[model samples]
Target: MHRRTFLKSSAAGALVMATTSWPLGARTRDRIRVAMIGTGLRGQSQLGPLLSRDDVELVAICDTQQVMLDKTLAIIEKTGRRKPKVYGGNGDVRAWKALLAQKGIDAVFIVTPWEWHASMSIAAMQAGIAVGCEVVAGITLQDHWDVLRAQQRTGTPYMLLENVCYRRDVLAVLQMVRAGLFGELVHMQAGYQHDLRAVKFNSGNPNEPYGSGAEFGDKGFSEAQWRTQHSIDRNGELYPSHGIGPCAMYANIHRGNRFTHINAFASKARGLHEYIVEHPKGGANHPNAGVKFKLGDVVTTTLRCENGETILLQHDTSLPRPYSLGFRVQGTDGLWMDVNKSIHVEGKSPAHKWEQAQKYYDEYDHPLWRNYAAKAAGAGHGGMDWFVIHAFIEALKANTPMPIDIYDAVAWSAITPLSEQSIAEDYKTLAFPDFTEGKWKDRKPIFALDGRY
Candidate 1:
């Protein structure tokens, strides 16, 4: 079916969803009342795109910090949008629960720290609210299961908010794969290769609210800047979604294929420790300055897919390095690499040479991009965020399955903890938790060039 026809049908299907009274987003008028939790950097970035929409109403904004709550409310008001109900998560742990209990909200976006994902998401679904959560679903193996079980029990659909999957170039390559431009997929490589040294160390910048001490607590850092704290405690791939999300989509993970096992190797932790030791800010006598960080600057994880394909994942955020997700999809016929933005067709290309991938983009940009690439969706991360939020709202209004559902969320995010375990055991091959319990074998792909998402 054509992309437009599929979207129209999906829109029609969304209407059928409105008949149900128990579900939150399944309202008859197709107007979605939304709530945003953690209105810091990530959450604040989402406001422009969300506020621009006529069908979406920002009914509430929740954050543990008073600054974020009041700031976001003012921003929403400036848009002439309704002043969203504010929920301060400061000292009270259940502040958001009260907001979720308030009858009006249809969906909640959990953009908080790594730890709260499962609990908040499970709670929101139980409260009859749909969810759009940020990456790295949960912090533990059990956390992953709870997220899946809660959504399943509540019969609520969720979007993982993996924006990289919808990136224009990423989508273009996906289109090529769907069109058989790359034949018989074999191996792929992706990674988090950005240097976040300054970000990890500059924890208390007074000018920027995110950099302020409120993110982790009054302990000189707030949970919003929790990545640094996470590094001090863990040793393996602390965050893997930026690299894994796109590769998972290309590999068709949790749809027809799943990661069978993981073997991880880590270089000794050096970045954060060295930064503290060298900097004058955190006196050398300070406990944190003298502490040893367990997380390695570089971690390499290899995943074996059930279909005999291999994925090479690199976790390299701590050290000095230029940013590169290293998105490379290779097959029997050709290969495409994101860092270089180039592809080579096996027999059709000049002998063993890399050609400009720009040549193929016009012909192969995905159907989704063909429709909305030029139109600004008022979102960040190179306009992909708009598409993801668009998909989430559309799914909510239409009452369809999210493009990146609970299974995908768990399967992709579980890598961090699983990699930690593998590295702890001297790089032993660890089996992955089958969150789907083998249902991937028969599940049809929810995301497609058909544009149903």
Candidate 2:
């Protein structure tokens, strides 16, 4: 099928699955009544962008810790916007459910811990509200399936807030793929390669907070206080979405094909542990000073798709390294590599040579980015956060499906647990779950396909 036709078909499937109409307040074409289920760093981070939009209203904010909740409340109160119903207190585990039980909220942004991702999204959908969730994949393999089924059964929209998928450069590459600039896609590589020594070691430190705390966060990391725990208890591709989101888009995963299997392996753990030993913080005898991190410093995962395309994903955040997604897309006729910011196309470039990728930016930058590039200025993470939030708001207003829908969200995020299992068995190759169950082969694109939303 033609690409446009495929897109329409994919949209048709979403329409059939959607809840027939926008829920509650959104049905009236009024400002979107949004509730925030977590008030830590990410929740407030997303708040800044949403608050800037006149199309959305902050109706509620919830968090388990009272200090953090009040800090968020102060943020909302300072705006002098109508005070949203606040939920949660110190040790309030049930606070999120109360936020969902609210009657007028049109949608919510889930920026809580990884463990809450699937459950919160599922509950929000079941409550007839839409969801925009932060990502690191899911806590467990079944978490992905549950999130998908909840959207299908409830017909409410669930979008994984994968900013990388809509990234300016990545979208340009997608334009190239669709235009046949990269002929017959064969392999791709990407990874989470940022050094998080400061963030990981700063966890639990009163002076040096991590997660929601470090980057404008007042309360340090919240939720399960979880990141360090993962380092202590397990290892192996724990955060795979950053690497896989864009790669999946290039490969057309869960649309024309799916990941069939993955073989994963990890190197010895050292980064965070060594950081603590070298630069201890907070108390002179900090508890982390004695803790040994179980997570490996580096993890590499290789996946085979049903359509013969291969993907290499690496998780290297805990180590010391310069930041990059490590993006590279190779095909029968051409290739593009991110680290060097260059591309080489067969017959189009000098023989056996590399050319600056910037040469094609003017002609190939995705239209969505081109159009919103100005407004998205200074938004965050190279304006990607702006584009993604824009997509969510636009989808809400138009009542169209999300750019990164449930299938895409789950398929990309689900790689975490599946990779964990592969590493656990001493680098065994494991089959990937067909999250679409077989609907993928005949499916079309759900996100924008030709400069149109």
Candidate 3:
């Protein structure tokens, strides 16, 4: 759809949503009334603790599964918190729309699957409510583009909750980088390496904690079903931000530079495809794998920023290994590498290698740490989760610019389809869309308020 027509439709949808009743009272003056959608694994498991904060009021909950909603509400009730009204059954968007229409709700949290991310976020923004969406914010490249436009048209703040940016070690690296300890920040390497072939492919019978039957079902089902059940590999860097977040900080992506081009390549997955072929009942026999992926292992994507800085992002869910983000920043002055816990320098300074690298690291246990770190400590992916949420809230409350604004969301999320396109074209380099219109070049990097630098 054209941008204008799509936006008009979205605006109409928002108008319909705004007609619902709300319970705005004295209580809402202090708390940001929030409604959470999709209370499944990520929602209840990792996001629940972070959302149940004092500054926010969990007013309503929506889910496809009634039992999951009930469990979530029960937990809230047990905590002596205000129990949220539950909505289930067909058309969760309508239920959430009603919640958004209500005057009681100031914001909506979208914990839904990747498919619903764009629509839900757009709906919330149109309904005059701020939105917080999980990582890699949009589903398609068009979705990412539309979201940025929607945010602009509606003037509602939208946040992509990239929790990895607030990791303790990552935050420390930012501080050191700001101190010129990391030098010119030449290049970076990071990744989210996780193996889930068995569960993903559904090997050895069906294991469903929520229910029965194989999650992917038979191979003749629907393409949509496969998307949810299988790994998020529609694009090469479909999940790049887990690694890109830390890398972006070191490279100063939104601060002064931006990703210029990206080239991605997927390693031969013939071995994995053959394994699935040999063991049809091993879970890979499902219709989900009908004919799409015939490859085996890794999908490595390389991003080239405007300043000639490069970021290497790699992910492979078909392999088995402990989750590790190989984060390293190779700067011109000094280098901070988490993989080897070493620092390299090429200046007229002390030849500090292993010993000095230890000193370079800062312990996140200070008084200011207590203030900013308390709320963020409970966030998923270490503590980066809460920081993203809190920062967005602070932006809305204080009427300040979002720490990671629409431009950042677009730039970060652009890796999704861009990398996919690159990989499809045999790892051809694709120029990145200038989401910021070069505005980020005039902005300064947002540093932690803890005075670490």
Candidate 4:
């Protein structure tokens, strides 16, 4: 969609949604009336915590697929809570606008596909509703800037729900970094290196096990319905927030530091095609086997920060491999590598020897984890999901700033389009846009600093 047309439609939608006047600075309400857009697997995960909370009320839900809506409704029914108004049961893509137009919604969780994130967020914000959006804030560089401008124009809250930043070990590492265990931060490495072939292609049948077939688009299940198309359309770091979010906090991006420039390189595309050709449901004769995917099997990117720190991020999801973020935190004094689960400190450790990371994790365990471990137990992604949701809810309740605010959101998400541009130009270095508009020098790091949700 054209930028002007998107902005115009978003404004019109917001006007329709804002039937009642809401004070620009309004924060706390008796109960934060919450609506959800896109009740897929990710949306349901957020729904569970919202249902469990006393201060939140599920006001509405929207989705293009009845199957997903029905499954979500079933989950809500089991909780015995009041049923929310439903929208988008019959493949109406614009049902979310109707949900937004309803009265008395203070916040909205936008757990939709990557492409819809920017527009939905802009509309929600324009309607004076706080937005808690899923990763990769937008698909294109322009989308990132547009989202940023919308948040600035409207004084509404916007938070990126990047759960990996709250992972137990990552939090422990954050604590260690603050304590100067990893002194004089210099360089770090992280990546989304996972085998997502199964996730990218699956049978449409709900009864069959997920990832059982190599059919995507309308014939695919869950993410395969839309996520695989990106492989055929683009070549770059398709998903970078999972790896960059935590690393950004450690390096203080947009908080007295910022990424100055970046360059990326992409390996040949072979994994997805190979997976489809070899699958039992799809042979060499299958129509999908003839498709050419543009996404590289592995894309590597290097980012230079203004504070003289450097970061390396890798996006590898098409091939067969074990799941790992491949995080490495290195500084002048010591370093830690998640792949080996090992840490080395200059003076604390015996000469050039590596110590198991568990001891350090236990020693410098973040206070947030220590305080909320019981509450977070059984939540998604090793209890990190609970923390991210907690942060959003608590921030809204307390009328405070989000842990991951608009600037951080755009900076992390812009990696995707910037990397694409870099690779297209034969690995040319590109200046990272300053989404903060020169205010990053004064911004302070407040994410999980005191362990107070």
Candidate 5:
């Protein structure tokens, strides 16, 4: 069947599995009724903010693990807020569907695993609930397309909760870019280069220090329970949005410019195995030491944009390194490198010398950060999480478009699967699918125009 016909015919059957009672339309409630799916570590981070906001009412929460659900409830209890209906127990993985079926939920925050993001977001959009989804929108090229189609068909609000785009320093760079400080953009580089060896392996005990054990899979805790499996199965840029989202905004991607093609290469995959063998809790005889991780120690991807700008992204985990996005924004006149925290502009600094980026960042600090610094004081991820969540809530309340909408979500996320395909094809360049379908030519840049959010 045709794709659209297939969607139309199949949507009804899908909805039958988790039908919402509320009719599809704009809600008139004074407070936005919210639901949370996957109340794990990431979900808990978002819960504090949702609970703190008087304008939001967390109506329900869902997670398969009783421990996670209890942890989330305790967080809610501390705030003295009315407890939300709990879902998920007895190994019911589909508890989120029941949460979606309930009435009075105006929006949902999906902080589930990478694989569940697309499907849950689709279900929420189909149910006429706004979606505040975490991280790369989906795991595959088709998943991205399906999410875009669902939002387009449902006319529901969908925002990718990528906090890095709102990171204070990133926003400062964005301001500099808009003010023509970078001159005409030429090339940009960024990546998720933080060492995650410990994060990929952990003891199942929540009380133990995280990342202190070399156990994974059924014996792992938090992210290690699932996130590590990706390394054993995938050989691409598994997580790209943390680096790509900010770059997309810097280059006005999907807003008159878009990624045209990409090529990717992966280094060897010895980092995980070596970590398993070297850790105190593990040894050469450890079972995990024998588990082959397909993800490379370093995965490099290069993308060409329609506007003649090139982007280089690296996925480096499972190795020893300080945490850094490894951001480098370069143009005709100047460049900013985050690793060294320095910026060099033509004629603005001593010849062939780098200036401290602090002054520049201070001068170009984004208005949002300036206005909300006090309110966002402790909201995780260096306060950027506050900004992204604030944006989602404000847009939903005002019935306005999201700063980082569905197109941006899918575009940044599609890089992962596209890069995967490229590597599988011997690093051959592949055409970047236009999720916007040519609408990018007329789409206007609307991310963080002012301090409104």
Candidate 6:
């Protein structure tokens, strides 16, 4: 079947499901009415727990592709949960206006592809709904600017759900950083390197993987798609936040300082070209096999923060290697390194190495995290996800400040396209667009609730 026709059929089926489900805001419960947009693999598989919680109500679901929508609806069906209204449109396709029009929805969880993050988020915010958007936050430099404007204009909270910040080990490192164990954090390194080409593609039958439910099933896209078929030769830091999150936390990024400027460098695209040329399946017919691709496969960006702190952000997607976030932090008084999983202190009488790090650095108790850890622990991202949601709901409940303010979301996602521009210019340094208008300098961590270790 044609992709468009199949998508339309799935969309109609979704409307049917929505009619059968409970009406929006039916019970008048205190649950935060939430909606899931782009219910693809990541949103369906991972977002289930958060939506299922009693604290929130899933009032609506939207997606451009029908296959994913059906999969998401099935989850709602099995849980006996009040199913949400479903909408389908491809890339600002159709359901957005109607989805945002739902007055019952208090917040929207956007898990769409990188391109649509900014516009969809802006639309939802303008509709008076808080937005929790997926990573690669903004697609273009102007898009980043537009998102901040929308948030400020609407007074709706905007959050980038960068779950890496909540990973178990990353949290452990944050605990240490909070205690001043990493005193005067100096420089850091972070990156995301995971090669999935072999596992992402099946050599034999193109359509062997069937069923949306199967782990390796259709997986949504066809084999002819770009991300799977094309080799990422000289790709600039493809996935950066796995390293950026830990680095940002260690450097006290939002508390006072901010990233100032960055210079990027990318390796030649020869390796990926060779693979496309040599692969038996498609030799001369391969795209760019004979013609060289301009972009490099690996890109490393060096950043200098407003406070003179330096950081290294690397991206290597072409080669096969074990996944590593490459998190490391150094401070004036002490240092906590993820690669070593060890902490070092300046005092001569260093009682214990790792123990000392834990005592001084990894003590999870913080004035901000102490109060909400229990409630947040049940959510995803090893509890951080809960914290993020807590901050959003609390802002609505108390009319207080947003945990991750509009500027934070803008800054976190701005790196997506800016990094790309840096690579295009032969890794020349690119000045970061200041979304805060110099206001972020005084910004605190926005830690609303206390966290206990």
* Winner by TM-score: 4
Sort the predicted structures by TM-score, highest score first.
Answer: 4, 5, 1, 2, 3, 6
Candidate 5 positional error at 167, Å: 0.7
Measured by lDDT, the strongest candidate is 4
Instruction: Give me the displacement of residue 204 in model 1, in angstroms.
Output: 2.1
Candidate 6 has a TM-score of: 0.78
Worst 10 residues of 4 by lDDT: 16-25
Off by over 4 Å in 2: 1-30, 78-80, 203-207, 210-224, 280-286, 450-453
Which candidate, 3 or 4, would have the higher TM-score against the true structure? 4
lDDT per residue as tens, model 3, 135-211: 76786789888888777767676777777776666776776776676567778888877654444444212124321
lDDT of each: 0.78, 0.77, 0.66, 0.89, 0.88, 0.63
Residue 401's lDDT within candidate 5 is: 79
The alpha-carbon deviation from the true structure for residue 35 of candidate 4, after best TM-score superposition, in angstroms, is: 0.8
Candidate 3: Cα lDDT at 358: 53
- Candidate 2 or 6, higher lDDT? 2
With a 3 Å backbone cut-off (N, CA, C), the pairs that clash in candidate 2 are 41-212
Scored by lDDT, model 5 comes in at: 0.88
Location of the lowest summed lDDT over 10 successive residues in candidate 6:
209-218
419 in model 5: Cα distance from truth in Å?
0.8
How many Å off is the CA of 427 in candidate 5? Answer: 0.6
lDDT of 2: 0.77
Steric clash pairs (candidate 5):
none
Give the better candidate number (2 or 3) by TM-score.
2
Q: How accurate locally is residue 402 in candidate 1, as Cα lDDT from 0 to 100?
A: 78
RMSD in angstroms between candidate 3 and the native structure over all alpha carbons: 5.1
Determine which window of 10 residues in candidate 5 has minimal summed lDDT: 16-25
Which scores greater on TM-score, model 4 or model 6?
Answer: 4
Window of ten residues with lowest summed lDDT in model 1: 209-218
Question: What TM-score would candidate 5 get against the native?
Answer: 0.95
